[model samples]
Target: MEQLLDEFRSTMDIPWSIWSARLVGTVVLCGLIGFEREVDKRQAGIRTHILVGLASALYCIVMQHLVVSDEFATDRVRTDPIRVVEAVTQGVAFLAAGLVVFHQGNVRGLKTGATMWLSAAIGLACGLGLWGLAVTTTIIAIVIIVLFRKIEQKAGTHVPGHKNAGEKEA
Candidate 1:
């Protein structure tokens, strides 16, 4: 068991400590957001959110290492950070799309999909060492999910696409 762990650690060019910190942060942030979704009976909840965030963070870490390598610095190999961001965004977009459902002319799960996307973004931020950004975004997400729900309920405002009376039947 010790040898297996050592081999795995050696395979990672990054220090295991760094990986541990980023992954844990990703899990925590995503888990908190996902807990809210779970409470609301979302199909994709804590486990899904944690996995998505972990994957994004791992991708970012690998890309970061490649971009900073000496080969790129010496050979003038152009590295565009936006490309990495775009790739992650596209991957997350696919997952988000899967979360949405259109049934009988009504669209549902937009909030769940959006929150999943946010989880990926927070993971990316953590991977890039933007700890402050990830924390702030998580707090804001929780606030929106919890507080806004109360406000919506008290005001009796039907969400725009959620079976609103003015919406036409498909």
Candidate 2:
């Protein structure tokens, strides 16, 4: 009884303001990338991106609470935070794999899948209170998706048999 109370209290020690900031950051940063995808008419859009980002952020927050609560145990079980990160990556990879498709000798969704993976990473960073990292990464991803595509088209690099890009997987 007392043990449960102590664990609960420990977890609740985190400030609500901090929690709100992380969650909001995850949404905004991930949304920017998602909006890019929406503009491109990709399958995954703003809602999907926001959902992934929010879920990832929630998982990280849960992990944080668990870690804090673990401290109140009589037998403090040391946890490797890396494990939580690995778990998140594995889950995100599963989602990313779903976004990819191969058809007509022209692979599609690879970029979208990669974007999903990036969204997860950004969400994780936001959840972990790395606002700058999340923001910078979002900006870089937007540039790669938006500006790079323009550059590729202008250079005719994205066309099949173009010099810049190799043949997609058969």
Candidate 3:
């Protein structure tokens, strides 16, 4: 059993230390962003955000390891990691589409959808060992999602497009 575990770890090509760090960091980042969404009662809150981030990070690690393997190395082999980014973006678009609703002329969950996309990007950064970037981006995203909403609401009164609450536009 121990041998099998060791072999599996080796196949993943991540040192246990680094893997543990990545896991913790990804979870923290996801939770931080998710907490903001949860406070706003968003649909894709804690679990959804964490799952997306962790899965994307894992996928990135696997893809990178495979591309760098000895057997796959060729004299002219070209492996562009951007392909992974593109694929993840395309796939996440489908997830985002599902969050959109056509009823009542109200579009909800758009921020949640965007949060998922950013979570995935953070995960990719974590997978590539860019801890500083991932952490900074997560903090910035949280601030934007939480703090900016309040600012926008307060400033809405003075903004031209936003009329007083009880007043209808002419």
The lDDT leader among the candidates is 1
Cα RMSDs, all models:
4.7, 5.5, 5.3
Q: Indicate whether candidate 1 or candidate 2 has the larger TM-score.
A: 2
lDDT of 3 by residue, 28-116 (tens): 89878877778666778888888888877887887778687876688777778888888877777789779866545545567778998
For residues 56-163, write the lDDT of model 1, one tens digit per residue: 898888888877776577655888877878998999999899878887676777888999899999999988888999999999999988899889867865343345
Ranking by lDDT: 1, 2, 3
Clashes of each: 0, 0, 0
lDDT of 2 by residue, 25-139 (tens): 9999989999988877778888888888888888888788877774545465775677777888898889889867666565677877788888888989988898889999999
What's the TM-score of each model vs. the native? 0.81, 0.82, 0.80
User: Which of the two candidates, 1 or 3, achieves a greater TM-score against the reference?
Assistant: 1
Q: Rank the candidates by TM-score, best first.
A: 2, 1, 3
TM-score for candidate 1: 0.81
Clashing pairs in 3: none
lDDT winner, 2 or 3? 2
Model 1 weakest 10-residue run by lDDT: 157-166
